[model samples]
Target: MTDTTALSQTETVQSKADVVQVTALTGSIGAAISGVRLTNINDDQFVAIRTAFHEYCMLVFRDQFLSVEEHVAFTARWGEFGFNKMSPQLDDYPMVLPLSNRGKSKAVTENWHYDSTFMTEPPAITTLSARDIPVGGDTMWSNQYLAYETLSPGLKAMLAGVRAEFTGTRLAKLYGLDQVPRCLHPVVRTHPETGRKALYIGKPGDTVPRFEGMTPTESEPLLRFLYEHSAQPDHIYRHQWRNGDLVMWDNRCTMHYAVHDYGNEMRELHRVTISGDRPV
Candidate 1:
């Protein structure tokens, strides 16, 4: 009989070659990658894609069309997939979190915040796929590192010794948590992989307190100023999806928001989060 194993190996390599293609977007914001069906990527191809993702910070894969299992498996190829401890849409697949807002079901993720920052161990990466889309459902992402880099040297100097406190209690109030997360992160943190500093201050539930030597009243206006200036369009990219598209983004240096114009037509997306190391 023919060596089926060799044939399978050959087929996999051929499939990967036929399926993978990468395209970068404008303003150093995002990339549009095509080919290499996620469910069937090989080890070598996966490494290449992972490298591209790190360089791009955000990658958009068109024509994924993965089932929940395949979607979770594809995300697992990059890193450990974390369970969703917040949304009620989680099912038997603990690692798969569904993001949908249909009819009376309100959509979450309306603000610009890093996912699961309340935890002592926050996620490193997050993968999302569109299942359903309304006529105008779109997602936007902003680069925090770029935001910090563009700041005036005077402000950057002022912020050098400043830090902000993030509390789970404040976040808990927004999400209706019985208990708050037990971790705190620096307002400015350095990325372990890239060794770049970024503003790590935006979350839906942040309670701004004085930075030790500074008072709360003295800190709030500056914090708000940084928050507003950091989210400017020069640092933002918006993704308008097509069916079967998958996106994976670095949570360490990016923040995202889901647009609300989809209305009642229904939008379904699945997310898988990768474990993250502490910021330096």
Candidate 2:
């Protein structure tokens, strides 16, 4: 992990004294934020948090045992709520979805994917608060910005302005739905906040059906390469979940895979998503 202080240009000298401590989890992406509480974040602290969020693409807060109300409130600070229709929501708190090993045939997130990319405007951010963690339910996130930036000039030019069809195939299968939800988004999309380009492709048969104006056969090789290249070990940060841990990732700039190694030990998390604009 790389240790660095996060400071915004607009930060005052006094604000600097209270700035949150950010340590990079990996050379490529993610940071661990300390010295602040999400329950009662002041304006200055929020500014620093936002800075670390945009720069790191994912933030990890340890030892935050947030209630459903607190989870919703902190997530709303990011943006409007983006609900997941396929997942079961909490009875009283409809916006919070419970992710558990109670009644699932298989783990839907074992493969890497951006959250709800099938939507016309997929979620910009997703936050998960660990409720009941087992021994090994770690999740890994890959940096999509680095994915796009590392591509060759020719491949980059080829992908520029290209769009792909994203589908909710895995979730559809998991829930035994009749029809899958699908949408078209740019293969490489520019982030609205940071103005950096990120590879928007996914595991072809799983989340992505094919590139627009191309047949499945024509798209397979390139899609496979991009998906594999985007998730190289160097560009990823594997987070081992601890009890009372709350993690948030920018879905627009990252893809995450959930490891299901804990078996039936009962791992549960409360998840909240923030809505985002349509991909341009």
Candidate 3:
């Protein structure tokens, strides 16, 4: 197979499972899968999908168009559901969170972030089902593995034992809340599954603010550098949304940006997350 649209076969265990194909979308982070439907996935298919999920931090299932119930059922196979604390879930089902352009407050997701990072135990996986995509509402994801791996030896060594304060400031404002959640997480965290390290900082004073025990003024420069360095073009993939698209990413190893260029045009997505343990 050629390298443009599909992945060259490798000696991975998933190759032994079934005919399901895992095609790498970008050189860095994502892959597209085919052959097995999420609604009727078999044990062998599930094994193949799960293997790809670990090997590639993000998986894009084009034209899946899963219903809210089906989306919840698929997420259940990964782990316990990670509920949103700020936004109310879709009507009756508390596990399905809705993000629509009509919801003015949903703009908080426009920034680059991992889901629920302020929580002591942030989510591991986040699944989004796209609908009514406008012309320019594309989303971009970056590989944190590259962010950590490409850092200078000196910088990586400096960040080894440091922790930073992650806060829900921007989200709190969107939700009209007073008390935002905050927690300290290692500046460089190891992904429990892949055992790869990632830079855990986001937009400095916004999502994360200062290193633990240091004043914001002191931690400003380095934190800013890491955030800026992490999104270099080679390590990123900008996903143009399509109707009925399903994208699931490992929150532990990737950070995503939701573009707000759609203006007044309509865009809708339902999100489901799988709970993860505290970062190591």
The local distance difference test score of each candidate is: 0.72, 0.88, 0.85
lDDT by residue (36-137, candidate 1, tens digit) is 778887777787676666666798888889998898888887678777666565657888777777443344466677777767667999998899877877
TM-score per prediction, in order, is 0.84, 0.93, 0.93
For model 2, residues 158-247, the per-residue Cα lDDT tens digits are: 888899999988889889999999999999999999999999988977788789999888999999999999899989999999988999
Candidate 1 structure, TM-score to reference: 0.84
List the candidates ranked by lDDT, beginning with the highest: 2, 3, 1
Model 3 stretches astray by more than 4 angstroms: 1-17, 102-106
Worst 10-residue lDDT window for candidate 1 reads: 3-12
Error of 1 at 110 (Å): 1.4
Q: Write the per-residue lDDT of candidate 3 for residues 1-280, one digit (tens) a residue.
A: 3212223443334544567878887777788888768898888888888888887789899989888888889889999998886888888789898888854446887877888889999999999998678898899999888889888889989898999999999878877888988999997899997888888888888888899989999999998899988898877889998988889999999999998887788888899999999987
* lDDT, model 2: 0.88
In model 3, the clashing pairs are none
* By TM-score: ranked, best first: 2, 3, 1
Better of 1 and 2 by TM-score: 2
